[model samples]
Target: MAGKVQKIKDWKGSEQKGTLKLQEAEVPRAALTDAISEDILCDLAELFKVFGDSTRIKILYDLFSGEKNVTEICRDLEMNQSAVSHQLKILRTAKLVQGRREGKSIVYALADEHVKMIIAMGIEHTEE
Candidate 1:
């Protein structure tokens, strides 16, 4: 049933009698497939995957403030050079951030204003 409410049981104990609880029971919402476009779903999955990693999240946070070279980012995070470089590469590939060569180093920053907003929104959501 698409909208039929039901309850199963909790891990702690058996199901309480006479309680019609809508638990994790898989009640398929037929409208969901219609509600979300494929493109939107793909984009959301990509965004979540990008944000899933602690290293990438930190990299985004570092770039959120302003442009910084790999060395600067490494120092701030107290991470190794190669580790920071790897995360930066992933962020760049995702187009969440971009970098330009400055002297001997490539300075990275948020590719678009949306990036900062995305990070801010994430922080706000998780903090709450």
Candidate 2:
């Protein structure tokens, strides 16, 4: 498969670490030095932490195409209800999955464009 795909590598704290907007600033070089507050890295690390689990990855994979209830995910992935539920709880807390009450069941879907794009880019990387 060959096509256009958006890709973002894990931030490799290079010399050019911050975004380009900061890079283009007309301020002095010393002022241009990125003095990152410790919390910024911590928050970014937490973002990756959400993607660091196999179970969570599977939950995202199962729902990649569209929303699905617990039963649908369990049945499609051949997982037990407890197993799917546990993974889903983690995804929900990460804000990676959104749940809505639909009759007796809740449907879960990817929470944002960024999550979907990252997953798509990951797929593309492996495919490449």
Candidate 3:
């Protein structure tokens, strides 16, 4: 099988053992220019950074079921109120979640359908 494999000119193998090779490709300058702007790229990076935390992921998973207040989230996830609030602050800043005043407490939920889609896709990928 190794002998039957074909190699491309733009891909080069690394000298180190058990490491993957790097592949280079040329894309049109027009396409590159029309691609995401630097500011948007930075914002996207910031959004993904929020998703990188396991605690935040748990909070998000619970929120997926329905909206819940900080106290409820803490109780359901077995996390402390302060810790949940801190994570909620980060999630809110990233626009992944939003909260609304409900009587004496604020109920939080996914910010938009995009948040649900992101979480759904992540779960699908992991299951596969």
Candidate 4:
């Protein structure tokens, strides 16, 4: 059977001027079958959402160098302890940051090299 051609329409419920015909093309079934699962796609989207907030990005940037207590983070970022802690909680839940008890305070740092690479790539992209 011949491929189907679709009419390109415009907003006024009429055929557009100088309209181009769109033909259905054969898709690779293997590519579709090998695509990531919907659950994994949703999880990846959620992870990117965690990086969407400026406050969280600032917190991650601060933790890039070394582990820091909440007080030190607040002092460096000039943010309040409560605000910094709140952002940290979200970061921890996303597994982007990890914290360990240091004496009376909890020191926080990036969870792994993946986080650093992601941030570094983002910075490089923006610079370019």
lDDT of 2 by residue, 8-126 (tens): 24311123312111111123444335586789779768878888887778788767667899999988888899999998888888788999999999999988755755665566567
Q: Estimate, for each residue in 1-128, the C-alpha lDDT of model 4 and write its tens digit.
A: 22233332211111442222323334445534667989989999999999999999988877766789999999989999899999999999999999999898999998985676566556656879
Q: After superposition, how far is residue 47 of candidate 1 from its true place, in Å?
A: 1.9
- Between prediction 1 and prediction 2, the one with superior lDDT is 1
lDDT of every predicted structure (CA atoms): 0.72, 0.70, 0.76, 0.76
Local error of candidate 2 at residue 55 (angstroms): 1.9
Backbone clash pairs for candidate 1 read: none
Q: Mind giving the per-residue lDDT tens digits that candidate 3 earns over 22-84? A: 354454555445678899899888888899999999898787667899999999989999999
User: Candidate 3: lDDT over CA atoms?
Assistant: 0.76
Error of 2 at 122 (Å): 2.4
User: Which residue ranges in model 1 land beyond 4 Å of their true spot?
Assistant: 1-36
Model 4: runs farther than 4 Å from truth?
1-34
Q: Over the full model, what C-alpha lDDT does candidate 1 score relative to the true structure?
A: 0.72
Ranking by TM-score: 4, 3, 1, 2
Candidate 1's TM-score = 0.69
Weakest 10 consecutive residues of candidate 1 by summed lDDT: 10-19
List the pairs of residues colliding in candidate 2.
none
Tens digits of per-residue lDDT, candidate 1, 1-128, equal 53554443221112442222222334244533348889988998987898899998888776655789999999988999999999888889899889999988899988885665566556656779
For each predicted model, how many residue pairs clash, with residues at least 3 apart or on different chains?
0, 0, 0, 0
Query: What are the RMSDs of all candidates, in order?
Result: 13.6, 11.5, 13.1, 15.7
Instruction: Please list all clashing residue pairs in model 4, or write none if there are none.
Output: none
My TM-score estimates for the predictions, one after another, are 0.69, 0.67, 0.71, 0.72
